[model samples]
Target chain A: MFEEADPDLLPEGLSDRLPPLAAEALRVTRAMNDVLAGHGFDPVQPPMVEFERSLASRMAGTKRNRMVRFVDPASLRTLALRSDMTVQVGRIAATSLKDAARPLRLSYAGQVLFLKGNGLEPERERLQVGAEIIGNDTVAAASESVSLAIEALKAAGARDISVDFTLPDLVDTLAASSLPLPEAAVPAVRRELDAKDAGSLVAAGGEAYLPLLYATGPFATAIEKLAALDAGDAVASRIEGLKEIAAHIDGAARLTLDPTERHGFEYQSWFGFTIYASGVRGALGRGGTYRITSEGGHDEVATGFSLYPDPLIARGAGSAKIERLFLPLGHDRDAALRLRTIGWQTVAALDASDDARALGCTHVLDGKEPRAL
Target chain B: MFEEADPDLLPEGLSDRLPPLAAEALRVTRAMNDVLAGHGFDPVQPPMVEFERSLASRMAGTKRNRMVRFVDPASLRTLALRSDMTVQVGRIAATSLKDAARPLRLSYAGQVLFLKGNGLEPERERLQVGAEIIGNDTVAAASESVSLAIEALKAAGARDISVDFTLPDLVDTLAASSLPLPEAAVPAVRRELDAKDAGSLVAAGGEAYLPLLYATGPFATAIEKLAALDAGDAVASRIEGLKEIAAHIDGAARLTLDPTERHGFEYQSWFGFTIYASGVRGALGRGGTYRITSEGGHDEVATGFSLYPDPLIARGAGSAKIERLFLPLGHDRDAALRLRTIGWQTVAALDASDDARALGCTHVLDGKEPRAL
Candidate 1:
C-alpha cells in the first residue's frame, strides 16, 4: 500500500522543473539556440545510451566512471548512458553520418548525469546547452566557435561576458618535463601554474622548465610572457594562434589570455576558452579543440561549448517580455475563442493575470476590457 | 589505469545528441516552446534529482520504478533520478513557488531517463518536449493545450497528425466492475477494447458493463455510444465533460474517441489524448489531465502534453531550412569577418556547405562563386 501510494519517488541528484526558474531556463536555452542557429550551427540529438566500450574509449576520459551503466536485457551488451554530447557527436560523425559530410556543425541541449565527487556544489544533474563543430581544424574554425559562444551569451542578456583563452600545449609541455611527478601531483602542478606560481613550479621541477611553467596571464601579458620562455618556439606558435583568433573577433578587448587557467578534460587540445559574466563565480560557458580518431582512419579535430543555463537564470538573465490576456472568472468558451483569434494569449482568470504581470507581462486584458493589471 | 583513462562516462539511460537530428529536434522544441510561450506558458527547469519520498508520492501506480535510484552521501537520504518533469513541477509549485499566483502556464524541453523493462522498444532515455497548464480547470485551458499541441505538430512538419482522445473516468467505470478478469487475460481485454470489440467486451464483462465498455469511434459517434452506457449520473456527467472538451477543439473533426485507450501513468485523470503522425507507429506525443495533492496542503489540477523528439527525428520530421555560407579553403580572415558582419553564417570548409545544402540551404558561397548549391 505504501508503494502503491507513492511510486514516483525520484532518486537523489535529480529534480523536476516548475514555473519561473524552469521557464526562465527554457527561454534562455531557446534564445541561445536561436543565436547559434542564426549563425548556421545546425542542431542534432543522439541517443542517451551507447555501448560501454565506445563510452570507455580514451576520448571519453575520466568522464567514463561518472556514467550510470547497465546491461541491456535484450542484447546482453553493456550499455552506458552518455555524459556529454561532444563525444556522441564524434561517434555519429564517425559511424552514422560518416559518408554524408565533413566538418559538421551541430548544437545540442540535454541533461547529462555525472557520478558523484565531481565537486559540484550540490552534486546535481546538469541540463547542458552546448554546440559542437566537428571536422574542421583551423584558427578560423576555433575563432568562429568563440564568436558564436560570445554571441550566444549576449543573446541570453549577459552584459559583461568575457572570454579567457588558454593554450593546452603550454601546460602539456610543462607536464612532459622530468619532474619525477606522481600521478596525483599533476593536479597540483596544474593548480600552481594556473595560479602563476613560478616559484613553486621551479621548486618542484628544476630551473630548466621554470620559464615554460611561468608563462601565463591575461591574453596580452601571456603572449609577452610566452615569448620570454625557454621553450619559446612552442609557446610562441600557440600565442600566434591566439593572436589570429583575437584579430577575427570584433571585441578583442574582452579576450583574456590566462596561461594559468589549466583545469579541463584531458582531451582538450590547442586553443581552449572559458566564458564568464560579471558576478558569476564560474564560467557560464566553455569549449576547446580536441582530436578524435575516426572509423574512416584519421583523427578529426573539433571544438564545442556547453552553456550552464541555471546560473544564467540565477542571475535573472533571459526572461522574455510578453503581453497578457485575461479572461474573467466565468468567461464562456466563445469569448475565449474570440480573444485567441485576436492574437491575445488569454489567461482564464484575474489571478492568473496578476501572476503574468509579476512575470513582466506588459499588457493585460480582462475579457474584452484592455486594462492594466 | 582504467579509471584514469575515462572518468565522465554517462550514467545508464542518458544520451548525447548529434546532428542533423539534434539540430532538427532543437528547432522543433524551440518552435513548440514558442507556440506555448505565445500562449503565456513560461519556461521552468526543475532539479534533475529530488527526494525519493517526494517523487514516489506523486508517481503512484505508474511505471516510475524504471527510474534509477541512489543514496545521496551528504544527507544519507534516498534520492532518485527524475524520470519525468511533471512531478518535479508539482514539487516546485507546492514548495518554493507556493506563494506565487495560480494558473501557472509552464513549458519545458529536456532529456528524461527511464529504467529498463517498461516495454518501450527503443532506449528509455528521451528528449521530452512538453508544457503544463496548472491552476485552471476550464474547457478553455484544455482547448488551448490541445491547440498548442496541434500547432506544435504542424510546425514540426507532421503532415497527417491524428489525435486519439479518451476519458479516464470512463475507463474507471469499466475497471470497477466485479467481472472475473484473470491477470493473464487482461492484455487481451485491453487489446479488444482498443479495437472497439463490443461483442468481445460484452462476453468478457457480461451484460452489466457491456454498454460502457463498447463505446468507441470518431468523436461524434462515440458521444452517442457513451450516452447509452448503463453507468450512473456521475459517470454520465464525466462523459458530458469529455464531450464539452471535444466540442471546443478547433479541429475537432480530426479527433477519435477510444474509451479503451488507457495507456498512461496513474497520475492521469479526466481527459487523455495521444498524437500520431506519418512514419511513426507509436505516439508522437501524449498528454492528459491530472490532479496532484501536495504534502503542504496544496491541491492543484493540471494538464499538458509531451512530444518525444527522437522518434520525430528518426522519422525525418522537423527538418529546418537553413541558408549556407561557405568560405574557400584559404579564405582570408577579413572575408570571413565581412560575411559574418553581413549576417551570413560563414563556415571554414566546402564540406560544411554540402551539409547545409542537404538541410535545405540554397545559398552557398565558395570563394568568388556565390550561388545556390
Candidate 2:
C-alpha cells in the first residue's frame, strides 16, 4: 500500500519523535506521573503484548479491531499489542493485585501501538499517561480522580482545561428505560446525541427527552435543565450520582456538564469526563468510573483517567534549554568537570583541527574558563 | 500455547515492571541520554515499528531472526518491531540526516521487543539506551565516545565497570591474512577463540597464532604479548589503531584487551569493546567503529555504543522515597499547599470516613499540623 514510500520510512500513522520533542514528551509524562504518585497512585507497567483474553474482554467489540495481533513464536498463542491502557489496567487489578486491599491506586505511562488511528489522534502509536483507582464505588472516589486528573494536566502545563462530565452508560440506561426507542431507532438517536444535534435526537426519542437536548452548557444551567425533565427513576439516580461527583470537585479545572454526551469513550461507565485544553481541537484526556471484572467473573467498581500529552507537548513545555560547552583538544579534563558541575554541558573536541562551533558547541573552554563563542 | 497458565499471565519471556522498577528504568534512561546530549549527541527516537529493510540491513543475518515481525495493515509490506537500536540509528544516519555535517552525534533510549530473549537476558522486551557518533573514524572520536559511555554509566549508578577491547572482525581479518588458516578450520578455530580456548586455537591455526591465544587478561599484558608476536602488517596496523584509541582513553573504566574475542557483536568493523559491571554476569553494553552505507550505497565512517541499562537500574536508582502526606476531609487546602511546597506529597482524603494512613499516607494533617499516625 505504501508503494511510493521508502522502505526505511515509518509505517503509516507512526512517527519518529526527535530531540527537544522527544525530551518534551518525557518531561510531560514524568510531570503527570509524579502528580499521580503524589496522590498515592503507584505506577505499574504492563507488557506491550498480552493474550487477547486479558486485553480484549472489556473492550472486546471496539478495541479488538485496532490491536496489532500475531502468533507468539515461543507460546504459539495469539498475542496483540495493546491499543489502549484502561482495559489492561483492569486486567492488572483483577489478576496481579487480585488479592490486594480496596481502592487500589495504580498509575502508568507508556507507548501504545494501534493498527489504525482514530479521528482524534491520527497517529497509530501514542504515549498514554493514566491513573486508576479501583474497587471504590463512592462519589468521593470519582471526585478525587477528577481533581487529580486536572492537577496532573496542569502539572503537564496544560492551562484552562474544560472538563465535560457525562454519564457513560446513558445510552444503555435510555435503551432500558421507558423511552420507547424501538431497538432500531436507538442507534440513530444515540448518533444524534453524540453529534449534539438537538432537533434530530428529539425526532428520534420524542418530546420527553428535550431536556437532554438543552443539557449542554455550564453545570449550573445543565443540571436545572435536566431537573426540569421527567427522566425515569433509574436515570434519575444516575444523574444524582453525577451531581454528587460534581459537588465534590473543588473546581481545579474548568467544569462543565453534558448529560447526553456519549461518543469516543469506549469503557467509561458511571461518571465519565472528557477534558479539552483551551485551544486544542480534540480532547486532551478521558476518564470515568467503570465496572472491573475479576478473572472469576466477579465485578467491582473503579475510576480513573488517561491522557495523551502530545498536544500539551506540542505547545513546547519542559524542553531542555541548556547549551553545550566544548573543550578543545588538549583542554584540561579537570576544568571540563568543573564546568559540567556548574551547569554547563561539556562536549569534548575529538580532534585538534575541529572547530568547537562547527561541532555544535555554543561555548568553548579557553584556558581554564568557558567563553561564549 | 499457555493452555495451563492463567489468561492474565504474560508470555513466558515477557514481564511487567511495577512501580519502583519502572520508575528506576526511566530514570536511568534519562540519565544516560542526558549525558549523551551533553556531549553533542542530539536525541532521535525512531518509530517502534519499521519496514524490515530499514532495521535488518547491515544486521541482515543475526538481527532479522530475533525481530518480532508481521505484515503492516497500512503498507501491505512486512514490518518488524525493532530488536536492536544500532541498525536503526544507522538508517537514520543514512537518510534523514544524510547532509548532517561531519561527526553527527545522536542519542536514543526506548523499549525494544524481541521474538525471543537472548540467553543472557531472558525477557523478550527490554529498555535499550544508547548514543552514536557518526562521521569521524579517528581514535579521538572513539576515545570521546568511550569516555562519555563510562561517564553516563557512572551517572546511572553503576560502579566498577571494566571495558574489554577486541577487534570484532579480527577472525575474518586473520582468515584473509598471509597466516594460512585452512578454510575448513577457520570456523572451528573461531569457536575456540570465542570460548577463550588457547589450546584449540593453537592446534587449528598453527603455532603462529599462539600470541592470539596469549593476547588475553589485562590490557598491559595482552597488548605487550601481541606486539611481541610475528604478526603481519595488516594485523599490526589494526593493533596500532587500537593502541591509538587506547592512548586517548584515560582509564575512566577498567581497561582490558582480548584480541581474539568475537561473539555477540556482528556489526563492528574495528575497535569493538564490551562493558561489564562488577558482579554483573552479562555485558552491560557493546560498541565500536563501523562503516555506514547510504541507500545509494555510498559509505561513510562512524563510531558509537549501545547500553542495556536495565542491569544498572536493577540496583535501585530513582525510586521515590518521599512518603505522601494525608489531608483529611475538611483540612485546609492552603495548609496542604504549604506542606506540598515543602517537599510533602499530599494526598487529600476523599471522604469523611476515609482513614488517611489506610490510603497509603505516612502523615495526616490535623488542625494545620501534620502528625505521624
Candidate 3:
C-alpha cells in the first residue's frame, strides 16, 4: 500500500526531521528556554489557529500578511496559523496578566507556519524560541533583553553572536527636520541610510544628515558621533536612552551600531537590534524596544528577542547520541525495566542468534551479567 | 491600539497558555519523552503542515476528514496542517529510515489542529506525544508499548493510570463468519457485542460470537473464558496473541480487555488500546498494533502509544512557582547577571519609589545589603 500511497512525497518547503536532528531541535529549545526562565521570563503557549481578524491585531502590518488563513468548519470564521509568536504572547500579557505587575516577563518556543519563506530561509515552517518583557521600555530594560539574548545564544552554543543596535525612529526625526527632502525622496534616502552610503545620502539632497549616517560603529564611538549631529529631541532622547543601556550592559557581548536599519520591523519607534553569530548564515534573531498600546488607551514599553533553533541544530549543537544496553532473547522484563530506570537504553533481543554488539549496542545481557561487546 | 484591535479576542476554541500552565506542558512533554528515550525510542519532528494527499495516507478515513486544509501560494498545492502526527512519523520510518535497520524505534511530540473536535474532546487543537516501534508488531512490541505508555504517564505525574486493551479485528472476523444475518441486524449485533449483551447477541444471529464478548475482563480471566469458546483459527489466534502480550507485560500497570470496543481507530487490524488516569478527565491517548506496509510490498508489525500532557497538566503537576529577586534603580548589572547564573530570577526595579517587596519580589538589593523582603 505504501508503494501506491507513499506519504514521503512531502509538500515543497515542508520537511520531516528524523533522529538526531529532531532531538537536537528539542534540546536547543529547552536550553534557550531555561536561560530565559533563569531571568524571570515565564512561559506561554499560543494555539496554532486563530480568527484572521484577531490574528491581524497580534502582529504588525508586514508580519501579519505572511499568516496562512483558512475557514474553520465549525465557526465558519477565517482562521490563520500563527506566523509570529511574540504577538500571541503579547496578547496574553495584555489580558491574562494585565493586572499582575508593572513589568512582566514571559518566554515561549514552538513552530510557526508561513504562507511563504522570506529570502533564503526556504523552510515554510520554522522552530521559534523567544522571550518578551512588557511594561518597561527604558534603556535598562533594553540592555537586560539584549544581554539575555546573548546569554541564550551562548546556552545554545552559538559562537560570536554580534548584537547590532538600530534606531528605527531615526528616519522620522530626519524627515521632519530643517533639511527636509520631498516625499518622493524618502524611499531613496532610507535605502542610502540603511546601506550606510554617505555619498548616496548627500546626492539624494540629504547632505545635512551625513553626521548621523557616519555614526555607525562600537557603542561609545557611535554615541559620540551622534551627539555632534543637529538632531531633534526625539532622536536626542533615543541616544540618551542608548547611553543608559550601555552603562548597564556589562561586557556580556559585542554591541555594534547600525543607526538606520529597518527590515522586518516597521512598528518599532525606538531602539531596535539584530543578532548575527559567527560562521552561521543570516541573523540568529532580532528584538528591541517598541510602544505597546494597551486596551485602555495607554502605552507600555516592550522588548524581547527570538532565536531560530534550526541553525543551531544544523550545526549539531543540541543533543548527544543515546547509549544502549541489549538483552538476549526471552530476557527478564524486570531486568530490562530496571536498567531503564537507571537511565540505560535497553533493547530486548528478538532473536538469540542476533549479535547485540553488531546491532550497535554497547552492552549485552543474557543471564550472564551486562558484558561489554 | 488594543482597544480598537485587541489580539486577545482570539478565534473560538483557540487560547493562550500563560506562566505555570505553559511551563507545565513543557515539563510533562519532556518527562514523557525521557521515558520513551530510556526505552530506546528515538525522537523525530514532523513539520506542522504537509501535502493533503500525503497526509490522508497517514491516517484512517475518519481522522483524515478532520484535517484542516488550505492552498499554498507558492507551490499552488493544497496543504493541510497536521491533525495527527502518527502518519507523518510513519511516513518517515517507511521512507527515510527505510534502510537504517529492522524494528526501528522512534518517538515524537507536537501540536495537532483539527477541522473539528472528535467525540467529547472539543478542543480543536491538541498536544500529542508518542513513541512507535516499527518493523516488529509482535506481542513483545505491544507489551513494550503498553508498558512504556504507563511509565510515561507516571513520569508526567499521572495518578492511577489504567490501560484498556481491545481486539479491533474481531468485528471483521465476526462479519465474515458462516452465519447469514439481515442487513439491519448488523448494527444490532455490533451493539450487543460491544455492550456484552450475550442474550441480544444470540437473537441477532451472533450467538457463535458471544464467547469473545463474554471474555472481556482482566487478562487471565479473559483468556480462560475465551478457551471455552468454539472458535476458528482467526478468533483463536487473537486470544493466543493476548495471552502472549499479558505474559510479557509485568509490573507495568493494570490492564483490562475489551473485545468489542471500536471507535476512532478503524485502521488497526489487531490489538488496540486506550489509557486513562484516575482523577483525570478523558482518555490520555490511545495506540495499538497495526500493519505498517513498507515500500516494498510488505507489511511490518508496528506498535506505539501517544499520551496527551494536557490532562496531566490540568491536574497541575508541572513546574513550581517562579521566584523573583528585585534590584533597585542603578544597581550593579554584573551582580544581577551573577545572581541569575545561580538560578535567581532577577528583575530590575523600573521606578525608585515602587515597593519592590509588594511587587512579588522575595528578595531585594538596595545598596544597604541583599535582604529577603
Candidate 4:
C-alpha cells in the first residue's frame, strides 16, 4: 500500500489565517473600508479573474507575466488572476461608470495574487484595500488622496504615519526642458536615479540629474531645495503642486520628499507617494496621480492609492482575546440571543461534561447574567 | 494602425461589480458574517489558492477537475483555485486548530472559483459564506447548523426563508440491512431514487426502496411517512435525529424533507439541507453533518453549511441609494468631519463649479446641517 502525502501541507507563499488572526484581519479591512466609504467612495468588487489583455492594457507598467494566468475553459482564452485591482477600478471608471459624475470615488478590498513574489518578500498574495478618485488629478485631488490614505491607516491602528512624496514623471518633466537627456538614455537615467547612485547617474549621461539625488528627505527642506533648482516651467509647477499637497497634509503625518522615486509608482504620472508607520515594517501603502486608458485609448487623469496592510494586520493579529460566554445545556435560548445582540459571544454546550475554560470562554452564563469563571 | 481588441472586455462569466451593487454585496456578506460571529463562530480566512493534492485529499467528493488549476511557478506543482471552501476549513480544523478544542466553531466568507459553471447558471465565481462545527456531528450540532444558517439568511434581509432537509447516505444505510441490495447494484438504486422515477427505480433493482421516493415533502407529513417505513435500527436512529433537529428549528423556518436529495450534498453523511428565501431565485445556502479527512486519512465527524447568496444579493442590489451630503468649496472641514462621523457620506467639492446633485448628493451641507437638494 502506498503512503499518501500530507493533506495539511499548504502551497509555498500561502498559509491559513487561523483564529484571532483571521478576526483581526477582518477588523482591519472593515476599518479601512469604512474610512473610504465615509468620504463618499462607493465600493466596487471586480471578479478575481479577467482576460490577460484587459488587465494588462488598462494601465502602463502592469506586468502581464507577474499575474497567474490560465486558459479559461469557457472562453478558450487566457485569463489572468488580478495582481493589482487599481487597473480593474480604472476599467470600471472608463466603461461602466463613464457616464457618471466627474471624480468618481470608488473603493475596493480583495485578495490579489501574483505569479512570483517580490524580491525578499515570500508572500505572493496580499489584501489590497484602495480608493480611486477617477476623472481628476489636480493638486487638490493629490492633497485629498494623501490625507485620506493617512486617515485610513490611522483608523486601522497604525501610528506615527509618514507620507514620502515622489515625482514619477520628474525625469520626463526635466528632460523635456531643464535637464536635457538623449531620448534613448531616458530609461537608464530613471533606473540610476531610482538606485540613488550618483556614479551610475553620471555614467547614464544624466550628470545634470545628479541634483535630484540631494533634493530628497524631510519634505520641508527637500521641497525648498527642489524648488531652488532651475528646471524651467513644467518642473516649477510640479514643484508648487507638491508644495501645496505637502502643506495640505503637513500636520496629519510626517512628510518626506523623494522627487524621482519610482519603485512602485510604475504607472503614476506627475505625482506619487509611499506611506509608512512606525513599528510597521516597510511601506504601508502607496498612492499618486495617474491616468486610466479609456475604451477609445484616450487617457483620463486620476488620483488614488492602494494600501497593502498585511504587515499592519500581522502586527495586530492574535493580540486581542474576545470575551466568550459559555451557555450551558438547558439555558434560555432567547437570553443567549439577547446576550449575542449585546455583543456577547455565546458558545452553547452540546452535552454534559463540557468545560467552559477549556473551550476558551472567559465567562459562563449563570441563569441570565454572565459570571466570570 | 492595428486596431486593438476592447480592453474593457472581461472574460466570459467574469464581471466588474460597479457602485451600489458592489456596496450591497459587501453589506450582505458582512451581515451574514456578523451573525456567524455573534454565535461564537471564530472567523477563519483561507487562501484562494492551495495545492491541488492538499485540497483534493482533505475531503471526499471535492472534484479536482472542477477547480481552476495552474502550475505554481515557485514549486513546479499544480495549484488549484478553490471551488468549495468547506474542504479548506476542514484542513484548517484538522491541522492548525487540531489541539485547541473539540467542537470548534469556525466561520468564513470569501470568493470561490470554479473551472466550469454549474448547469444553466453562468457564474464561475461566487461569494461563499459559511460556518462549521468541527469535532461533532451530533443531532444538536446538526440542529445548530440548520438554525444558524437560517438566522444568517434572515440577518442578511432574506424573507420567508425555507430549509429543505435531506439524508445524503439514506440509500447506503437502508441497503445494508432493511432493504438489502447487491453491493454492485447500490449506485443505480441511489441514482434512480434521486431522479424520483418509480418505474426506473424498480428497473434499477431499487424496488425495495420504492417507499423512500414517496417519503419526501413538508417535514411534518414526510417525516411521519418515512417513520412508518419498517427499516429497523439504523434507519430508526436517523429518523429520531431528524425529528430532534426539526423540533429545534420548528418555527424558525418552513421545513421540508427529501431523504435522498444529493445534488449539492455530495460529501454530507447522515443529514443535509438546502436553504431558500422568497423572491430569491434559487437556494441561498446549504449545510449538513459530514466527515472531514484527517491527515492520517481517518474520518473526523464535522457539520457545517455554505451559503452562496449571489441570487439573494442580486435581488437586493441597487435597491438602496445611500444618502450622500455634498460640501461646497471652502466648507468648514471640522463641521463636515463631525457630520461624517455621524454616518453622513460627505463628498467635498474640488472646484466652485462642482454641482451637488450631479455628484449623487441628496443634501448640500449648509453651515453645519444638510439642506435637502
**Tens-digit per-residue lDDT, A161-265, candidate 2:** 788988867767777785666788778877787777778877876555556777778887887777666668877887787777777666666678887776655
Q: Against the true structure, what is model 2's DockQ?
A: 0.57
Task: Tell me the tens digit of each residue's lDDT in model 1 across B1-373.
Answer: 4433433333344444555556666666776776776667777776556666776676464444677566566446666656777777766666666666666777776667666634454466776778887775555566667767877777666767778777754544554543435555555666666666678866655445455455666777876787777466656766776676666665632878776567673566777788887777788878888876775467888878788767766555434454567655556656656666666665555342435554445565655545666
Total clashes for model 2: 0
Which CAPRI quality tier does the interface of model 3 achieve?
medium
Tens digits of per-residue lDDT for model 3 on A1-373?
A: 5335554677767787777788788778888888887776778998998766655664573356688887777766677888878777766777777776767788899998888886787789888888888877777778888888888888887987777889987876678774577878888888888787889988987788788777888877988898777576777788888877666566666778878878856767688888888878888888887766545454577887777868878787334766788887777767776787778887776545555665568887657467777
- As for TM-score, the candidate ahead, 3 or 4, is 4
lDDT assessment of candidate 3: 0.77
lDDT per residue as tens, model 3, B1-373: 4335554576656667766788888888889888887877778999898878767764563356788888878767678888778888777876778776767889999998888874677788878999888877777778778878888889998877777778886766657663445667778888887777788889888787776777777766876776677456777777787777766666466778877788755677688888988988879989888776544454567888777878788677444665678888878766776777778877677667656765668888656345778
Per-model CA lDDT versus the true structure: 0.65, 0.77, 0.77, 0.88
Q: How far is candidate 3 from the true structure (C-alpha RMSD, Å)?
A: 3.4
Flag the better candidate by lDDT, 1 or 4. Answer: 4
Docking class of 1: acceptable
Candidate 2 residues lying further than 4 Å off, grouped into runs, are A1-5, A60-62, A118-120, A174-189, A195-205, A230-252, A317-320, B1-5, B60-62, B174-189, B197-203, B230-251, B317-320, B352-355
The 10 consecutive residues of candidate 4 chain B with the worst lDDT sum are B1-10
Share of native interface contacts recovered by each model: 0.46, 0.59, 0.75, 0.81
**Deviation in angstroms for A102 in model 1?**
3.3
Off by over 4 Å in 4: A1-3, B1-3
Task: Write one digit per residue (lDDT tens) for candidate 2, span B1-373.
Answer: 3443467777878877765677777677767876776667777777788887777765543468888888877767888888888777878778777776667788888888888876767888888888888888767777777777888888888889889998877777777785677789878877887776678767766556666777888887888887777557877887787787677666777789988777656667877888888867788888888888745574888888888887777776445565778887778878887877676877766656666666667888888878987
